[model samples]
Target: MTAPYLIIFDVDGTLIDSQAHIVASMEAAFSGLDLPAPSRAQTLSIVGLSLPVAMLRLAPDHSAEMRADLVEGYKAAFQSLRLSADGAALSPLFEGAMSVLETLQADPRFVLAIATGKSRRGMEHILDQHGLRPYFASVQVADDHPSKPHPAMVKACLFECDVPAARAVVIGDTTYDVEMAKAAGAQAIGVSWGYHSVEDLRQSGADPILRRFGELPAALERIWSLT
Candidate 1:
């Protein structure tokens, strides 16, 4: 029998279109703390980072104590937006994302998984909303692992899926994702319709930046060939 291939996805910019909601949450956090909110582009630039690191990047002049406070504030504000009384999901899966996920999950040779900067609770909200929980066999979240650009999340997913680094792929939108994947000796693939630009993904060492969800299967086949 052929060994299994682990196809790991990132949550925020990769699967779900949460950029607007994320910007709103960051703005709310800054406003509550009487701090100036970073511009949308600046906020988007730090999308894949953990809250503390993201806070520092957005407000580099602030002290660690204040940055920590911002983290808590962002969490509370984001949580409020995520769990409104009406129970509507803030972030919707991008076009064709669901179909791509379903196709990948149904493929017997592959094991679908997630490696993301979202907290476990946040990740749960996304998966539950999209009914994606059953498709993933392994999940690594910011709550359990260090922020991206670190190989820990990738390593954990490979370990959990019982797949070697050479047999796994990290599909995401940010440079942090590319760096993290390569750090673990895994293939890094980027999507163009994400927060970061295709140029950024290339500069970060991503091999092929897919332009659409429909291209995912072919991207997978090509990437697997290289491995």
Candidate 2:
């Protein structure tokens, strides 16, 4: 029998384009707390990391207490701004995302999962709000495990799915995802339609940097063939 393929996706940039919301919410958080906000470049640089890690990156000199305060501030600001003036949070999935997800989910050969920096509650909120909660067979969130570059979260997903590392593929838009996949001995596929530039993804050691979401199946097929 052929081995099952486990496709683990990162939430923010890979599956959904939440850059605007992320940046705007973060800026609001800083402003609300009277703290120095990071620039777009700085924000993009830490896209796939956990909240505390991202906070450390942005405010290295901040005390642990201040970091905790900043996290709370960011979450409050995000919750407030996520909803539009019309009282709805508009989350736009990337082009061809739904079709691709549906296609992959329907395939008997593929097992879909999520490994994101978002907390489990945060991820569940987005999935439920977007009507995408039923698709994934497994999910590993930052709050449940150590952050990316540690591979613990990915390993957790693998454990949940009962798959070996070699049978898994990690998909994301950031270097952190690629690095984590490498650490976990899984194939890494980076998406160009995210916070990191193509060059950045390539430099981060992704085997194939996908330009379109539609190309995901083909990329996975290629990786499977090699493995």
Candidate 3:
């Protein structure tokens, strides 16, 4: 049998549509500090980064202390929103996401994994909510690794799964994901439905950019076929 290929997915913008909660929590965090919130685009642009790094980029003019406070505030606000009565609606899986995951889960040639900037608790909540905990053979979160574009998270996931970078692919909706995968010597596939633009994904070296979730399986096959 061929060695099982590792397919590492990024969580927030890629698999889960958490934009509603993400933007609202960012606004609430800024409001709590009497600071103006970042615009929706600005907030979304930093979606794949760790909270601290995201705050720095979004609120660059603010003091480190202020940014630190924003980090805590955002975490609290996001958790609150997650536990709200309509939380499930605030972060639904993208259309066709579940079906594709199910398909991949049944494929013996692939081993699924997660690499994301979300905290372990936050990622866990999402997994539990969507019954996705079993879909991933390995999970790497921001709590344990440096932020994206650093390659640590992807490298860690590859390590834990005992899969070589050449036999793995990273799928996400952001330039950070593309860069991270490239830095780790893994191929990257970008999803257009996520926060980042398709042009950005292309510029960052993602090939076979997927226009929708349904196209993923074919894209994966195409990628591996060329290797």
Which predicted model would earn the best TM-score?
3
lDDT of 2 at 141: 86
Q: For model 3, how does the per-residue alpha-carbon lDDT over 68-159 read when each residue is reduced to its tens digit?
A: 99999999999999989998999999999999999999988899999999999999999999999889999999999999989999898888
Full ranking by lDDT: 3, 1, 2
- lDDT tens per residue, model 1, 1-227: 66799999998899999987899899999999898899999999999888888988899999999898899888898889888763454688989999998898888889998999999888998888889999999989998888999999999999888899999989999999999999999999999989999999999999889999899998898877833
User: All candidates' lDDT scores?
Assistant: 0.90, 0.85, 0.94
For model 3 the local lDDT of residue 146 reads 91
> Which stretches of candidate 3 lie above 4 Å from their native place?
none
Q: Candidate 1: where is the Cα deviation over 4 Å?
A: 85-89
Clashes of each: 0, 0, 0
Candidate 3, residue 113: lDDT: 97
Best by lDDT: 3
Instruction: Estimate the TM-score of every prediction.
Output: 0.96, 0.94, 0.98
